[model samples]
Target: MIAYLIGNIKDKYEDFVILETNGIGYEIFIPFPFDENYIKIYIFEHIKEDCYDLYGFLTFKDKEIFKKLISINGVGPRTACQMIKTYGIDQLINYIILEDTKSLSQIIGIGPKISKRIVLELKDIFLKKYSQNIYSTYKYDAVLALMALGYSKLDSQNSVNNIFLPNDTTEDIIKKALQILAQKV
Candidate 1:
């Protein structure tokens, strides 16, 4: 029932952190590394027959993604956390929407089959918002231009992934993508 926590981190482990609040130390499993000694984190508590665990995230988006992932038949909290840790929220959503199972399967415990299943199950639910916002108008236009220039979808995607910064225009993205593609050639 612990929904959130704001405390000083007393210790850190490879897969978890010990957060002390009001003199009580609570062990919270985390998906990624955190260097801060003080943190305010959202939490998800999973209680089962022999296990009661708390998983923490710095953002609500991550918590929601974790919840969605663990709801899948073959995915558990740990697996879901690993997924977020590996690809991060933005890249993971893009991979799912694009049905790029090869990249998705690159994570340690994920295989081709699971990656496909993840895409099949979550793409429709998340694709629209992510596609519209994350890609942005100019970046999307740049991808289309790359496609028109004969780049394969995957090549174009890799060329421009997260390459746009604030205020970058279509021309800027196209230039960057071409530069990346040229380096690969």
Candidate 2:
């Protein structure tokens, strides 16, 4: 079982990332997909109970905070991931610090009871730890980035929003988008 990987970020996505490690590319996904990408990322692997999964974070401390997240009794990996994905590690940690169980409960699958329990059990651990980096890391975001190119308005934004990072400048956006379009032929 691979505990973690360090490599050149060959590709990055909202749900998955490909790292080129030791001449091999590894495919990894966070427990839950973030709604946005604040920065490119790094990840920790958790393989157990018949599952091969990844939890991504901008820093090693973020990964540690995620570990604290899943430890809550009912949280599990998916729920923990949902919490992070819904509000990000920073926001969620902020909620816990501020005693905002209501916001945490709003996450899908996190009922009132579970929300309270999450706050009760583990809030203190993550209170001030995740402040360093919690937002996304992608440049210009994928959506605005596509529109800034020439992918029409709706089609480009939606497609870029849905796919992974196209980490490049405006010129690169045009070149890559055209390359992607050409592949359809």
Candidate 3:
């Protein structure tokens, strides 16, 4: 399997880009638009009986999320790409964690059923994978405090994740996260 590709962009299209590497061009469908002349993309190759396609992501996290999304029934690669392109990885995760099916259903191709399925299937997976760190308890409390202060779950989690220190208490994390959030405004 081709894991990744580092190349110069040869052309840009609505959903895909032509990347040239080693005197070869690869047409890769991307989740979002990129303006860089060169890039390193984590790739997911899809093979069918008579077709082969490549999906490219800017980060390994994005590629992993895409894989998870496509694993759900009724969620195709294109639908997964659209969801990511529309809501972004962080906000999408937030929506899933919160079980905000209405928000997810706002996407072009995602209906209520698929949105609910996405949330139901991925919520535990995300929480387990992302929140099982040594400081998970403290981090979770800090994130809840930030959310109570009216910050978005995405912003709260992001601040907490960035500002957490090994020795800090939940209150310390909250204070540091507030400082980080204040700097953004």
Candidate 4:
């Protein structure tokens, strides 16, 4: 198994990113937190029925958490990514600690039944490695904007909270959330 890859970013696509190390380009699954600091990443490869998928995480803890997430009965990589995208690792940790299955289900692709299962199975694993410092600094102003525009807090939270990779700042979050929210009106 490949442990990790440290390289320069050769190119980035919409879903996958190409990292060049020693003249080889490794395309890894693009996590939302892949930014300037994540050009070099540790990867976990999962062999499936028809394909091998490489999931990337900037930290070993994150990779471990990802592994635990996918280990849930029905939680797949996509759902795990969706979970991280929506509430991030801290909120996920918080939710797990609080047993907030409702919040977990709010993540795209994670239903209540599956979320309850996740809370039951993986909560202990994630809380042990959860980092509050990183996610505490994480702030999203977009949700506030959506709330200001008369959208429900949960809706706004879910909308701006579910942005894809290429992690944006509070300002960027607001801009993109507005663009997405505009589609509704």
What is the clash count of model 4?
0
Question: How many clashes in each structure?
Answer: 0, 7, 0, 0
lDDT of 1 at 133: 43
Residues 1-185 of candidate 3: C-alpha lDDT, one tens digit per residue: 99999999999999999999999999999988788988999999999998899999999999999999999998989999999999788777767776889999998778999999998999999867764333666788899999999999999999998988877888899999999999999
Error of 1 at 144 (Å): 16
RMSD of 3: 6.6
lDDT of 4: 0.72
lDDT minimum window of 10 residues, candidate 4: 131-140
Each candidate's lDDT (Cα)? 0.84, 0.63, 0.89, 0.72
Q: Flag clash pairs in model 2.
A: 37-136, 37-137, 38-136, 38-137, 38-138, 39-136, 39-137
Q: How close is candidate 1 to the true structure, as a TM-score?
A: 0.73
Q: Pick out the ten consecutive residues of candidate 2 with the lowest summed lDDT.
A: 131-140
The best-first sequence of candidates by lDDT reads 3, 1, 4, 2
| Residue 144 in model 3: lDDT | 95
Report residue 33 deviation for candidate 1 (angstroms).
2.4
What is the C-alpha lDDT profile of model 1 across 1-185, one tens digit per residue? 78799999998998899999999999999997778999998999999999999999998888888898887777889888888888787777877776889988887777888888888998888875566544565577789999999998888877887577756777988999899998888
TM-score of each: 0.73, 0.57, 0.71, 0.65
- Ten-residue region with minimum lDDT total, candidate 3: 129-138
Candidate No. with top lDDT: 3
Off by over 4 Å in 4: 127-185
| Model 4 lDDT per residue over 87-166, tens place | 77666776776578988888777888988888888766655655342233233445666688787887677666676334
Reference-based lDDT, residue 27, model 1:
95
